[model samples]
Target: MPYIPTRYFCLIAALVTLAIAVSARFATNDYFFFAGYVVLQYVVMATAWNILGGYTGYVNFGTAGFFAIGAYSAVVMHKLFEPPLVVSIAVGGVMSGLVGLGMGYLTLRLRGVFFAIATLALAIVLQTLITNWDFVGGSRGVYIIRPANGPFGHPYIQYLFLTMLVLSTIAVCIARAIEHSKLGYGLATIRDDELAAEAAGVPTLKLKLIATVLSGALMGMAGAPLPYYVTYLDPSSGFNLAFAVNSIAMPLIGGTSSWLGPVIGALLLATIQQIATVTISSALNLLIVGVIMVGFVVAAPNGIVGLFERGVRARRRPAKKEAA
Candidate 1:
Protein backbone atom coordinates (compact mmCIF):
# COMPACT_ATOMS: atom_id res chain seq x y z
CA MET A 1 0.00 0.00 0.00
CA PRO A 2 1.05 3.60 -0.67
CA TYR A 3 2.02 5.81 2.19
CA ILE A 4 -0.82 8.02 3.47
CA PRO A 5 0.18 11.58 4.14
CA THR A 6 -0.34 13.11 7.57
CA ARG A 7 -2.49 15.87 6.08
CA TYR A 8 -4.90 13.35 4.50
CA PHE A 9 -5.06 11.42 7.73
CA CYS A 10 -5.91 14.56 9.65
CA LEU A 11 -8.55 15.51 7.09
CA ILE A 12 -10.19 12.13 7.34
CA ALA A 13 -10.16 12.27 11.10
CA ALA A 14 -11.77 15.72 11.08
CA LEU A 15 -14.52 14.61 8.70
CA VAL A 16 -15.19 11.51 10.76
CA THR A 17 -15.48 13.62 13.88
CA LEU A 18 -17.88 16.02 12.19
CA ALA A 19 -20.04 13.17 10.97
CA ILE A 20 -20.20 11.71 14.44
CA ALA A 21 -21.07 15.08 15.91
CA VAL A 22 -23.91 15.59 13.44
CA SER A 23 -25.19 12.08 13.89
CA ALA A 24 -25.15 12.45 17.66
CA ARG A 25 -27.64 15.32 17.44
CA PHE A 26 -30.23 13.10 15.73
CA ALA A 27 -29.76 10.49 18.43
CA THR A 28 -30.71 13.13 20.98
CA ASN A 29 -33.76 15.46 20.83
CA ASP A 30 -34.89 18.42 18.73
CA TYR A 31 -33.57 21.19 20.97
CA PHE A 32 -29.94 20.12 20.72
CA PHE A 33 -30.29 19.63 16.99
CA PHE A 34 -31.74 23.10 16.56
CA ALA A 35 -29.03 24.62 18.72
CA GLY A 36 -26.40 23.07 16.46
CA TYR A 37 -28.30 24.34 13.44
CA VAL A 38 -28.24 27.90 14.76
CA VAL A 39 -24.51 27.79 15.28
CA LEU A 40 -23.92 26.52 11.77
CA GLN A 41 -26.20 29.25 10.41
CA TYR A 42 -24.15 31.88 12.20
CA VAL A 43 -21.02 30.35 10.73
CA VAL A 44 -22.43 30.78 7.25
CA MET A 45 -23.46 34.36 7.94
CA ALA A 46 -20.11 35.25 9.43
CA THR A 47 -18.23 33.76 6.47
CA ALA A 48 -20.42 35.68 4.04
CA TRP A 49 -19.77 38.95 5.85
CA ASN A 50 -16.05 38.22 5.84
CA ILE A 51 -15.98 38.31 2.03
CA LEU A 52 -16.67 42.02 1.92
CA GLY A 53 -15.71 43.20 5.37
CA GLY A 54 -12.61 41.09 5.82
CA TYR A 55 -11.16 40.53 2.35
CA THR A 56 -12.26 43.74 0.69
CA GLY A 57 -11.86 46.01 3.70
CA TYR A 58 -15.46 47.17 3.56
CA VAL A 59 -17.32 47.15 6.83
CA ASN A 60 -20.92 46.47 5.89
CA PHE A 61 -23.22 47.09 8.83
CA GLY A 62 -26.28 46.06 6.85
CA THR A 63 -25.89 42.28 6.80
CA ALA A 64 -29.14 41.88 8.73
CA GLY A 65 -30.92 43.88 6.07
CA PHE A 66 -29.89 41.38 3.39
CA PHE A 67 -30.67 38.50 5.74
CA ALA A 68 -34.18 39.81 6.35
CA ILE A 69 -34.73 40.37 2.66
CA GLY A 70 -33.80 36.77 2.00
CA ALA A 71 -36.11 35.48 4.71
CA TYR A 72 -38.99 37.57 3.43
CA SER A 73 -38.29 36.52 -0.13
CA ALA A 74 -38.56 32.90 0.95
CA VAL A 75 -41.76 33.65 2.82
CA VAL A 76 -43.25 35.55 -0.09
CA MET A 77 -42.41 32.74 -2.50
CA HIS A 78 -43.81 30.16 -0.14
CA LYS A 79 -47.05 32.16 0.14
CA LEU A 80 -47.54 33.17 -3.48
CA PHE A 81 -46.08 30.30 -5.46
CA GLU A 82 -45.66 27.69 -2.77
CA PRO A 83 -42.37 26.61 -4.24
CA PRO A 84 -40.31 23.84 -2.74
CA LEU A 85 -37.63 24.68 -0.23
CA VAL A 86 -34.87 24.67 -2.85
CA VAL A 87 -36.68 27.08 -5.14
CA SER A 88 -37.56 29.36 -2.26
CA ILE A 89 -33.94 29.51 -1.19
CA ALA A 90 -32.87 30.31 -4.77
CA VAL A 91 -35.36 33.13 -4.92
CA GLY A 92 -34.05 34.48 -1.66
CA GLY A 93 -30.53 34.56 -3.04
CA VAL A 94 -31.60 36.28 -6.25
CA MET A 95 -33.64 38.94 -4.49
CA SER A 96 -30.88 39.65 -2.01
CA GLY A 97 -28.20 39.70 -4.70
CA LEU A 98 -30.12 42.24 -6.76
CA VAL A 99 -30.61 44.45 -3.74
CA GLY A 100 -26.96 44.13 -2.84
CA LEU A 101 -25.89 45.04 -6.37
CA GLY A 102 -28.01 48.17 -6.26
CA MET A 103 -26.64 49.04 -2.86
CA GLY A 104 -23.09 48.48 -4.03
CA TYR A 105 -23.60 50.84 -6.93
CA LEU A 106 -25.09 53.46 -4.66
CA THR A 107 -22.58 53.31 -1.83
CA LEU A 108 -19.37 52.14 -3.48
CA ARG A 109 -18.83 55.82 -4.10
CA LEU A 110 -18.22 56.30 -0.39
CA ARG A 111 -15.20 55.07 1.52
CA GLY A 112 -14.29 53.93 5.02
CA VAL A 113 -16.61 55.18 7.74
CA PHE A 114 -18.87 56.81 5.20
CA PHE A 115 -19.54 53.47 3.51
CA ALA A 116 -20.19 51.80 6.84
CA ILE A 117 -22.70 54.46 7.83
CA ALA A 118 -24.45 54.17 4.49
CA THR A 119 -24.89 50.43 4.82
CA LEU A 120 -26.12 50.81 8.38
CA ALA A 121 -28.70 53.33 7.19
CA LEU A 122 -29.72 50.96 4.42
CA ALA A 123 -30.54 48.29 7.00
CA ILE A 124 -32.64 50.71 9.04
CA VAL A 125 -34.55 51.83 5.95
CA LEU A 126 -35.25 48.27 4.90
CA GLN A 127 -36.47 47.39 8.37
CA THR A 128 -38.81 50.39 8.29
CA LEU A 129 -40.18 49.36 4.93
CA ILE A 130 -40.77 45.81 6.11
CA THR A 131 -42.49 47.18 9.17
CA ASN A 132 -45.02 49.09 7.04
CA TRP A 133 -45.55 46.48 4.28
CA ASP A 134 -48.41 44.41 5.90
CA PHE A 135 -48.64 41.86 3.13
CA VAL A 136 -45.93 39.57 4.40
CA GLY A 137 -47.16 40.08 7.96
CA GLY A 138 -45.48 43.48 8.23
CA SER A 139 -43.84 44.47 11.47
CA ARG A 140 -46.27 42.14 13.26
CA GLY A 141 -44.12 39.26 11.94
CA VAL A 142 -44.77 36.24 9.71
CA TYR A 143 -45.35 32.74 10.91
CA ILE A 144 -44.24 29.87 8.72
CA ILE A 145 -46.00 26.56 8.91
CA ARG A 146 -43.28 24.00 9.39
CA PRO A 147 -43.16 21.42 6.66
CA ALA A 148 -43.84 17.88 7.80
CA ASN A 149 -41.20 15.20 7.49
CA GLY A 150 -38.36 16.70 5.53
CA PRO A 151 -35.61 14.39 4.23
CA PHE A 152 -34.68 13.81 7.87
CA GLY A 153 -38.08 14.14 9.56
CA HIS A 154 -38.72 16.65 12.34
CA PRO A 155 -35.01 16.37 12.28
CA TYR A 156 -35.62 19.47 10.25
CA ILE A 157 -32.98 20.75 12.59
CA GLN A 158 -30.55 18.27 11.10
CA TYR A 159 -31.61 19.26 7.60
CA LEU A 160 -31.05 22.94 8.35
CA PHE A 161 -27.72 22.13 9.97
CA LEU A 162 -26.64 20.21 6.87
CA THR A 163 -27.73 23.08 4.66
CA MET A 164 -25.74 25.52 6.76
CA LEU A 165 -22.77 23.19 6.72
CA VAL A 166 -22.81 23.13 2.92
CA LEU A 167 -23.25 26.89 2.76
CA SER A 168 -20.35 27.52 5.13
CA THR A 169 -18.17 25.17 3.14
CA ILE A 170 -19.05 27.04 -0.03
CA ALA A 171 -18.36 30.35 1.67
CA VAL A 172 -14.92 29.19 2.74
CA CYS A 173 -14.12 27.94 -0.75
CA ILE A 174 -15.28 31.19 -2.32
CA ALA A 175 -13.32 33.28 0.17
CA ARG A 176 -10.23 31.16 -0.44
CA ALA A 177 -10.62 31.55 -4.20
CA ILE A 178 -10.99 35.30 -3.84
CA GLU A 179 -7.90 35.43 -1.65
CA HIS A 180 -5.86 33.59 -4.28
CA SER A 181 -7.19 35.08 -7.50
CA LYS A 182 -6.57 38.36 -9.27
CA LEU A 183 -9.71 39.60 -7.60
CA GLY A 184 -8.13 38.94 -4.23
CA TYR A 185 -5.00 40.82 -5.23
CA GLY A 186 -7.10 43.73 -6.44
CA LEU A 187 -9.05 43.68 -3.19
CA ALA A 188 -5.85 43.62 -1.18
CA THR A 189 -4.57 46.55 -3.19
CA ILE A 190 -7.80 48.40 -2.60
CA ARG A 191 -7.60 47.62 1.04
CA ASP A 192 -4.01 48.76 1.48
CA ASP A 193 -4.30 51.82 -0.78
CA GLU A 194 -7.22 52.46 -3.11
CA LEU A 195 -5.52 55.23 -5.02
CA ALA A 196 -2.57 52.96 -5.67
CA ALA A 197 -4.87 50.18 -6.80
CA GLU A 198 -6.62 52.51 -9.22
CA ALA A 199 -3.30 53.82 -10.50
CA ALA A 200 -2.31 50.22 -11.18
CA GLY A 201 -5.43 49.85 -13.36
CA VAL A 202 -7.48 47.84 -10.92
CA PRO A 203 -11.21 48.34 -11.38
CA THR A 204 -11.88 49.10 -7.74
CA LEU A 205 -15.55 49.82 -8.27
CA LYS A 206 -16.24 46.57 -10.11
CA LEU A 207 -14.30 44.50 -7.62
CA LYS A 208 -16.04 46.10 -4.70
CA LEU A 209 -19.48 45.49 -6.18
CA ILE A 210 -18.60 41.90 -6.97
CA ALA A 211 -17.52 41.34 -3.40
CA THR A 212 -20.67 42.94 -2.02
CA VAL A 213 -23.01 40.97 -4.27
CA LEU A 214 -21.30 37.69 -3.56
CA SER A 215 -21.28 38.39 0.15
CA GLY A 216 -24.93 39.45 0.17
CA ALA A 217 -26.04 36.47 -1.88
CA LEU A 218 -24.40 34.02 0.50
CA MET A 219 -25.91 35.80 3.51
CA GLY A 220 -29.30 35.70 1.84
CA MET A 221 -29.00 31.99 1.28
CA ALA A 222 -28.07 31.54 4.93
CA GLY A 223 -31.26 33.34 5.96
CA ALA A 224 -33.54 31.48 3.55
CA PRO A 225 -34.20 28.56 5.88
CA LEU A 226 -34.25 30.84 8.91
CA PRO A 227 -37.98 31.57 8.73
CA TYR A 228 -38.70 27.88 8.78
CA TYR A 229 -36.02 27.26 11.39
CA VAL A 230 -37.36 29.76 13.87
CA THR A 231 -40.94 29.27 12.58
CA TYR A 232 -41.36 33.03 12.86
CA LEU A 233 -39.97 36.15 11.24
CA ASP A 234 -40.35 39.73 12.39
CA PRO A 235 -38.59 42.97 11.56
CA SER A 236 -37.04 43.05 15.01
CA SER A 237 -35.78 39.50 14.89
CA GLY A 238 -34.93 39.42 11.21
CA PHE A 239 -33.02 42.67 11.22
CA ASN A 240 -31.45 42.43 14.62
CA LEU A 241 -28.21 44.27 15.43
CA ALA A 242 -26.79 41.01 16.70
CA PHE A 243 -26.44 39.86 13.10
CA ALA A 244 -24.38 42.89 12.21
CA VAL A 245 -22.25 42.65 15.32
CA ASN A 246 -21.61 38.93 15.07
CA SER A 247 -20.78 39.11 11.39
CA ILE A 248 -18.30 41.89 11.95
CA ALA A 249 -16.86 40.61 15.18
CA MET A 250 -16.20 37.04 14.01
CA PRO A 251 -14.06 38.03 11.07
CA LEU A 252 -12.25 40.75 12.95
CA ILE A 253 -11.46 38.60 15.93
CA GLY A 254 -10.41 35.54 13.97
CA GLY A 255 -8.29 37.32 11.33
CA THR A 256 -9.90 39.04 8.38
CA SER A 257 -6.91 38.59 6.10
CA SER A 258 -7.46 34.85 5.78
CA TRP A 259 -10.45 32.77 4.79
CA LEU A 260 -10.28 30.61 7.92
CA GLY A 261 -10.48 33.59 10.24
CA PRO A 262 -14.24 34.07 10.27
CA VAL A 263 -14.85 30.34 10.50
CA ILE A 264 -12.49 30.06 13.45
CA GLY A 265 -14.03 33.07 15.13
CA ALA A 266 -17.59 31.87 14.51
CA LEU A 267 -16.87 28.41 15.94
CA LEU A 268 -15.17 29.83 19.02
CA LEU A 269 -17.73 32.53 19.73
CA ALA A 270 -20.78 30.44 18.89
CA THR A 271 -19.60 27.59 21.09
CA ILE A 272 -18.92 29.98 23.95
CA GLN A 273 -22.35 31.54 23.54
CA GLN A 274 -24.06 28.17 23.42
CA ILE A 275 -22.25 26.93 26.51
CA ALA A 276 -22.95 30.17 28.33
CA THR A 277 -26.62 30.11 27.37
CA VAL A 278 -26.83 26.75 29.08
CA THR A 279 -24.63 27.26 32.14
CA ILE A 280 -24.94 31.00 32.56
CA SER A 281 -27.45 33.61 31.37
CA SER A 282 -28.16 34.42 27.75
CA ALA A 283 -27.43 38.05 28.54
CA LEU A 284 -24.06 36.99 29.85
CA ASN A 285 -23.31 35.42 26.49
CA LEU A 286 -23.57 38.74 24.73
CA LEU A 287 -21.54 40.32 27.49
CA ILE A 288 -18.87 37.72 26.90
CA VAL A 289 -18.88 38.47 23.19
CA GLY A 290 -18.55 42.17 23.90
CA VAL A 291 -15.64 41.66 26.23
CA ILE A 292 -13.91 39.33 23.78
CA MET A 293 -14.39 41.77 20.93
CA VAL A 294 -12.93 44.65 22.97
CA GLY A 295 -10.02 42.54 24.10
CA PHE A 296 -9.22 41.42 20.55
CA VAL A 297 -9.46 44.90 19.16
CA VAL A 298 -7.20 46.42 21.77
CA ALA A 299 -4.70 43.60 22.24
CA ALA A 300 -4.65 41.66 18.98
CA PRO A 301 -6.09 43.81 16.27
CA ASN A 302 -4.80 41.43 13.62
CA GLY A 303 -6.78 38.58 15.22
CA ILE A 304 -6.08 35.03 16.39
CA VAL A 305 -4.85 33.88 12.98
CA GLY A 306 -2.29 36.64 12.98
CA LEU A 307 -1.13 35.66 16.42
CA PHE A 308 -0.82 32.04 15.34
CA GLU A 309 1.22 33.02 12.31
CA ARG A 310 3.52 35.12 14.49
CA GLY A 311 4.01 32.22 16.82
CA VAL A 312 4.84 29.87 13.95
CA ARG A 313 7.44 32.37 12.72
CA ALA A 314 8.87 32.72 16.21
CA ARG A 315 9.24 28.95 16.56
CA ARG A 316 10.92 28.70 13.14
CA ARG A 317 13.45 31.35 14.26
CA PRO A 318 14.96 29.04 16.91
CA ALA A 319 15.29 26.22 14.35
CA LYS A 320 17.03 28.59 11.91
CA LYS A 321 19.42 29.72 14.64
CA GLU A 322 20.22 26.12 15.56
CA ALA A 323 20.91 25.27 11.90
CA ALA A 324 23.16 28.35 11.57
Candidate 2:
Protein backbone atom coordinates (compact mmCIF):
# COMPACT_ATOMS: atom_id res chain seq x y z
CA MET A 1 0.00 0.00 0.00
CA PRO A 2 1.06 3.54 -0.71
CA TYR A 3 1.88 5.81 2.19
CA ILE A 4 -0.89 7.82 3.82
CA PRO A 5 -0.26 11.34 5.09
CA THR A 6 0.02 11.52 8.84
CA ARG A 7 -2.12 14.63 9.11
CA TYR A 8 -5.01 13.14 7.16
CA PHE A 9 -4.87 9.80 8.91
CA CYS A 10 -4.71 11.29 12.40
CA LEU A 11 -7.45 13.80 11.72
CA ILE A 12 -9.76 11.10 10.47
CA ALA A 13 -8.86 8.89 13.38
CA ALA A 14 -9.43 11.63 15.89
CA LEU A 15 -12.81 12.46 14.46
CA VAL A 16 -13.92 8.87 14.33
CA THR A 17 -12.67 8.08 17.81
CA LEU A 18 -14.22 11.18 19.27
CA ALA A 19 -17.48 10.42 17.51
CA ILE A 20 -17.59 6.98 19.03
CA ALA A 21 -16.79 8.35 22.46
CA VAL A 22 -19.59 10.88 22.13
CA SER A 23 -22.05 8.19 21.16
CA ALA A 24 -21.02 6.20 24.20
CA ARG A 25 -22.97 8.69 26.30
CA PHE A 26 -26.10 6.92 25.15
CA ALA A 27 -24.85 3.60 26.41
CA THR A 28 -27.53 2.05 28.61
CA ASN A 29 -24.98 0.19 30.61
CA ASP A 30 -22.67 2.52 32.50
CA TYR A 31 -20.38 -0.47 32.75
CA PHE A 32 -19.75 -0.21 29.03
CA PHE A 33 -18.49 3.32 29.40
CA PHE A 34 -16.29 2.31 32.30
CA ALA A 35 -14.85 -0.55 30.29
CA GLY A 36 -14.25 1.63 27.25
CA TYR A 37 -12.42 4.09 29.46
CA VAL A 38 -10.05 1.34 30.53
CA VAL A 39 -9.50 0.17 26.98
CA LEU A 40 -8.81 3.66 25.66
CA GLN A 41 -6.44 4.27 28.53
CA TYR A 42 -4.50 1.16 27.48
CA VAL A 43 -4.56 2.37 23.91
CA VAL A 44 -2.65 5.47 24.99
CA MET A 45 -0.35 3.48 27.22
CA ALA A 46 0.49 0.90 24.58
CA THR A 47 1.07 3.51 21.91
CA ALA A 48 3.37 5.43 24.22
CA TRP A 49 5.32 2.31 25.14
CA ASN A 50 5.64 1.38 21.46
CA ILE A 51 7.58 4.56 20.69
CA LEU A 52 10.53 3.27 22.70
CA GLY A 53 9.96 -0.47 22.61
CA GLY A 54 8.78 -0.88 19.03
CA TYR A 55 10.45 2.01 17.22
CA THR A 56 13.66 2.39 19.13
CA GLY A 57 13.95 -1.32 19.94
CA TYR A 58 14.46 -0.36 23.58
CA VAL A 59 12.30 -2.58 25.70
CA ASN A 60 11.46 -0.43 28.72
CA PHE A 61 9.94 -2.49 31.51
CA GLY A 62 9.40 0.61 33.64
CA THR A 63 6.05 1.48 32.18
CA ALA A 64 4.59 1.59 35.70
CA GLY A 65 7.35 3.90 36.88
CA PHE A 66 6.48 6.55 34.34
CA PHE A 67 2.79 5.91 34.80
CA ALA A 68 2.96 6.33 38.57
CA ILE A 69 5.14 9.39 38.23
CA GLY A 70 2.40 11.02 36.24
CA ALA A 71 -0.30 9.76 38.54
CA TYR A 72 1.39 11.07 41.63
CA SER A 73 2.41 14.25 39.89
CA ALA A 74 -1.24 14.95 39.24
CA VAL A 75 -2.17 13.93 42.74
CA VAL A 76 0.43 16.22 44.25
CA MET A 77 -0.68 19.04 42.03
CA HIS A 78 -4.29 18.45 42.84
CA LYS A 79 -3.56 18.64 46.55
CA LEU A 80 -1.30 21.67 46.26
CA PHE A 81 -3.14 23.90 43.80
CA GLU A 82 -6.30 22.08 42.70
CA PRO A 83 -5.51 22.57 39.05
CA PRO A 84 -7.78 21.35 36.30
CA LEU A 85 -7.19 17.98 34.70
CA VAL A 86 -5.56 19.55 31.65
CA VAL A 87 -2.98 21.30 33.77
CA SER A 88 -2.43 18.13 35.75
CA ILE A 89 -1.82 16.21 32.55
CA ALA A 90 0.62 18.81 31.28
CA VAL A 91 2.51 18.89 34.53
CA GLY A 92 2.62 15.12 34.70
CA GLY A 93 3.98 14.89 31.17
CA VAL A 94 6.68 17.45 31.88
CA MET A 95 7.65 15.82 35.16
CA SER A 96 7.80 12.33 33.68
CA GLY A 97 9.59 13.55 30.56
CA LEU A 98 12.32 15.08 32.67
CA VAL A 99 12.67 11.83 34.58
CA GLY A 100 12.85 9.93 31.31
CA LEU A 101 15.62 12.21 30.07
CA GLY A 102 17.66 11.63 33.21
CA MET A 103 17.15 7.90 33.08
CA GLY A 104 18.01 7.73 29.39
CA TYR A 105 21.20 9.70 29.85
CA LEU A 106 22.28 7.30 32.53
CA THR A 107 21.23 4.01 30.88
CA LEU A 108 20.78 4.47 27.12
CA ARG A 109 24.37 3.39 26.52
CA LEU A 110 23.49 -0.14 27.62
CA ARG A 111 22.15 -2.42 24.93
CA GLY A 112 19.57 -5.23 24.81
CA VAL A 113 19.06 -7.30 27.94
CA PHE A 114 21.15 -5.00 30.07
CA PHE A 115 19.02 -1.99 29.24
CA ALA A 116 15.80 -3.91 29.85
CA ILE A 117 17.02 -5.08 33.22
CA ALA A 118 17.96 -1.54 34.20
CA THR A 119 14.45 -0.33 33.41
CA LEU A 120 12.85 -3.03 35.50
CA ALA A 121 15.15 -2.01 38.32
CA LEU A 122 14.12 1.59 37.82
CA ALA A 123 10.48 0.64 38.24
CA ILE A 124 11.23 -1.18 41.47
CA VAL A 125 13.14 1.81 42.81
CA LEU A 126 10.33 4.20 41.99
CA GLN A 127 7.80 1.96 43.66
CA THR A 128 9.87 1.91 46.83
CA LEU A 129 10.12 5.69 46.87
CA ILE A 130 6.40 6.13 46.42
CA THR A 131 5.60 3.61 49.07
CA ASN A 132 7.38 5.74 51.66
CA TRP A 133 6.55 9.27 50.57
CA ASP A 134 3.81 10.18 53.04
CA PHE A 135 3.18 13.46 51.33
CA VAL A 136 1.20 11.63 48.66
CA GLY A 137 -0.35 9.40 51.35
CA GLY A 138 2.39 6.77 51.27
CA SER A 139 1.12 3.23 51.40
CA ARG A 140 -2.18 4.32 52.91
CA GLY A 141 -3.38 5.51 49.53
CA VAL A 142 -5.39 8.69 48.69
CA TYR A 143 -8.95 9.40 47.80
CA ILE A 144 -10.08 11.80 45.11
CA ILE A 145 -13.57 13.09 44.56
CA ARG A 146 -14.11 13.49 40.86
CA PRO A 147 -15.16 16.82 39.53
CA ALA A 148 -18.73 17.64 38.69
CA ASN A 149 -20.18 16.25 35.51
CA GLY A 150 -18.79 17.89 32.41
CA PRO A 151 -20.58 20.68 30.56
CA PHE A 152 -21.55 18.13 27.90
CA GLY A 153 -24.40 16.89 30.13
CA HIS A 154 -23.24 13.30 30.04
CA PRO A 155 -21.78 11.40 33.01
CA TYR A 156 -18.18 11.88 34.02
CA ILE A 157 -17.26 8.46 32.62
CA GLN A 158 -18.15 9.58 29.12
CA TYR A 159 -15.95 12.62 29.49
CA LEU A 160 -13.12 10.44 30.70
CA PHE A 161 -13.64 8.19 27.71
CA LEU A 162 -13.49 11.16 25.37
CA THR A 163 -10.38 12.48 27.04
CA MET A 164 -8.61 9.16 26.52
CA LEU A 165 -9.86 8.96 22.97
CA VAL A 166 -8.32 12.33 22.18
CA LEU A 167 -5.11 11.37 23.90
CA SER A 168 -4.91 8.10 21.97
CA THR A 169 -5.41 9.95 18.71
CA ILE A 170 -2.59 12.36 19.49
CA ALA A 171 -0.29 9.55 20.59
CA VAL A 172 -0.96 7.55 17.45
CA CYS A 173 -0.36 10.61 15.29
CA ILE A 174 2.97 11.33 16.88
CA ALA A 175 4.03 7.69 16.61
CA ARG A 176 3.12 7.59 12.92
CA ALA A 177 5.08 10.76 12.23
CA ILE A 178 8.15 9.43 13.98
CA GLU A 179 7.82 6.07 12.27
CA HIS A 180 8.07 7.67 8.82
CA SER A 181 10.78 10.21 9.55
CA LYS A 182 14.56 10.15 9.25
CA LEU A 183 14.62 9.66 13.02
CA GLY A 184 12.83 6.37 12.49
CA TYR A 185 15.57 5.19 10.16
CA GLY A 186 18.17 6.06 12.77
CA LEU A 187 16.23 4.21 15.46
CA ALA A 188 15.93 1.18 13.21
CA THR A 189 19.67 1.20 12.78
CA ILE A 190 20.15 1.29 16.52
CA ARG A 191 17.64 -1.45 17.04
CA ASP A 192 19.34 -3.70 14.50
CA ASP A 193 22.91 -2.93 15.59
CA GLU A 194 23.86 -0.09 17.91
CA LEU A 195 27.58 -0.37 17.20
CA ALA A 196 26.92 -0.17 13.49
CA ALA A 197 24.59 2.77 14.07
CA GLU A 198 27.32 4.62 15.93
CA ALA A 199 29.89 3.73 13.30
CA ALA A 200 27.57 5.22 10.68
CA GLY A 201 27.67 8.59 12.58
CA VAL A 202 24.25 8.22 14.14
CA PRO A 203 23.94 10.12 17.42
CA THR A 204 22.68 7.11 19.29
CA LEU A 205 22.40 8.74 22.69
CA LYS A 206 20.47 11.76 21.42
CA LEU A 207 17.98 9.63 19.53
CA LYS A 208 17.45 7.27 22.43
CA LEU A 209 16.91 10.17 24.80
CA ILE A 210 14.32 11.61 22.45
CA ALA A 211 12.51 8.28 22.35
CA THR A 212 12.63 7.99 26.14
CA VAL A 213 11.29 11.47 26.80
CA LEU A 214 8.47 11.12 24.31
CA SER A 215 7.48 7.69 25.53
CA GLY A 216 7.58 8.70 29.18
CA ALA A 217 5.66 11.88 28.52
CA LEU A 218 2.91 10.05 26.70
CA MET A 219 2.69 7.39 29.36
CA GLY A 220 2.45 10.12 31.94
CA MET A 221 -0.31 11.79 30.01
CA ALA A 222 -2.18 8.51 29.97
CA GLY A 223 -1.96 8.30 33.74
CA ALA A 224 -2.89 11.90 34.47
CA PRO A 225 -6.61 11.20 34.47
CA LEU A 226 -6.33 8.25 36.77
CA PRO A 227 -7.01 10.13 39.97
CA TYR A 228 -10.49 11.06 38.88
CA TYR A 229 -11.13 7.67 37.32
CA VAL A 230 -10.27 5.42 40.22
CA THR A 231 -11.25 7.88 42.99
CA TYR A 232 -8.94 5.95 45.31
CA LEU A 233 -5.28 5.45 44.55
CA ASP A 234 -2.42 3.60 46.17
CA PRO A 235 1.14 2.76 45.21
CA SER A 236 0.14 -0.77 44.37
CA SER A 237 -2.64 0.31 42.04
CA GLY A 238 -0.59 3.00 40.33
CA PHE A 239 2.46 0.80 40.03
CA ASN A 240 0.63 -2.31 39.00
CA LEU A 241 2.58 -4.87 36.99
CA ALA A 242 -0.27 -5.13 34.54
CA PHE A 243 0.58 -1.78 32.94
CA ALA A 244 4.10 -2.81 32.06
CA VAL A 245 3.18 -6.24 30.82
CA ASN A 246 0.14 -5.09 28.88
CA SER A 247 2.03 -2.22 27.31
CA ILE A 248 4.72 -4.60 26.06
CA ALA A 249 2.30 -7.30 25.02
CA MET A 250 -0.03 -5.00 23.07
CA PRO A 251 2.62 -3.73 20.68
CA LEU A 252 4.17 -7.14 20.28
CA ILE A 253 0.83 -8.73 19.54
CA GLY A 254 -0.21 -6.02 17.10
CA GLY A 255 3.14 -5.93 15.24
CA THR A 256 5.64 -3.51 16.71
CA SER A 257 7.13 -2.48 13.37
CA SER A 258 4.58 0.29 12.88
CA TRP A 259 2.51 2.80 14.89
CA LEU A 260 -0.81 1.17 14.00
CA GLY A 261 0.28 -2.01 15.68
CA PRO A 262 -0.12 -0.82 19.26
CA VAL A 263 -3.54 0.68 18.60
CA ILE A 264 -4.85 -2.59 17.20
CA GLY A 265 -3.18 -4.65 19.87
CA ALA A 266 -4.51 -2.59 22.78
CA LEU A 267 -8.08 -2.72 21.52
CA LEU A 268 -8.06 -6.45 21.01
CA LEU A 269 -6.22 -7.37 24.19
CA ALA A 270 -8.06 -4.95 26.44
CA THR A 271 -11.40 -6.07 25.10
CA ILE A 272 -10.50 -9.67 25.74
CA GLN A 273 -9.39 -8.89 29.27
CA GLN A 274 -12.60 -6.99 29.92
CA ILE A 275 -14.72 -9.94 28.81
CA ALA A 276 -12.54 -12.56 30.44
CA THR A 277 -12.56 -10.76 33.74
CA VAL A 278 -16.34 -10.92 33.84
CA THR A 279 -16.75 -14.46 32.57
CA ILE A 280 -13.80 -16.18 34.23
CA SER A 281 -12.10 -15.52 37.52
CA SER A 282 -10.34 -12.18 37.65
CA ALA A 283 -7.30 -14.01 38.96
CA LEU A 284 -7.00 -15.75 35.63
CA ASN A 285 -6.53 -12.53 33.64
CA LEU A 286 -2.76 -12.54 33.88
CA LEU A 287 -2.65 -16.23 33.20
CA ILE A 288 -4.69 -15.63 30.05
CA VAL A 289 -2.29 -12.94 28.94
CA GLY A 290 0.64 -15.24 29.54
CA VAL A 291 -0.90 -18.06 27.58
CA ILE A 292 -1.82 -15.83 24.66
CA MET A 293 1.57 -14.17 24.62
CA VAL A 294 3.40 -17.49 24.65
CA GLY A 295 1.20 -18.82 21.88
CA PHE A 296 1.81 -15.73 19.78
CA VAL A 297 5.53 -15.84 20.37
CA VAL A 298 5.70 -19.43 19.23
CA ALA A 299 3.13 -19.37 16.45
CA ALA A 300 3.14 -15.77 15.19
CA PRO A 301 6.38 -14.24 16.27
CA ASN A 302 5.68 -11.11 14.25
CA GLY A 303 2.09 -10.71 15.54
CA ILE A 304 -1.32 -10.39 13.91
CA VAL A 305 -0.27 -7.69 11.48
CA GLY A 306 2.69 -9.76 10.40
CA LEU A 307 0.50 -12.80 9.88
CA PHE A 308 -1.94 -10.79 7.80
CA GLU A 309 0.85 -9.40 5.69
CA ARG A 310 2.26 -12.86 5.14
CA GLY A 311 -1.10 -14.10 3.95
CA VAL A 312 -1.40 -11.24 1.52
CA ARG A 313 2.06 -11.90 0.19
CA ALA A 314 1.23 -15.57 -0.29
CA ARG A 315 -1.86 -14.69 -2.29
CA ARG A 316 0.08 -12.20 -4.38
CA ARG A 317 2.74 -14.78 -5.11
CA PRO A 318 0.16 -17.17 -6.53
CA ALA A 319 -1.39 -14.40 -8.65
CA LYS A 320 2.02 -13.35 -9.94
CA LYS A 321 2.82 -16.95 -10.88
CA GLU A 322 -0.44 -17.17 -12.81
CA ALA A 323 0.44 -13.96 -14.65
CA ALA A 324 3.89 -15.27 -15.50
What candidate 2 gets wrong by more than 4 Å, as runs, is none
The estimated TM-scores of all candidates read 0.92, 0.97
For candidate 2, give the lDDT of residue 232.
92
Model 2 Cα lDDT, one tens digit per residue, 39-59: 988998999998999888999
For model 1, the run of ten residues with the poorest summed lDDT? 1-10
Per-residue lDDT of candidate 1, residues 134-243 (tens digit): 98899799899876657656556666666767666666767777777789899888888889999999999999999999999988988888888888889899998888
Candidate 1 matches the true fold with a TM-score of: 0.92
Deviation of model 1 at 55, angstroms: 0.9
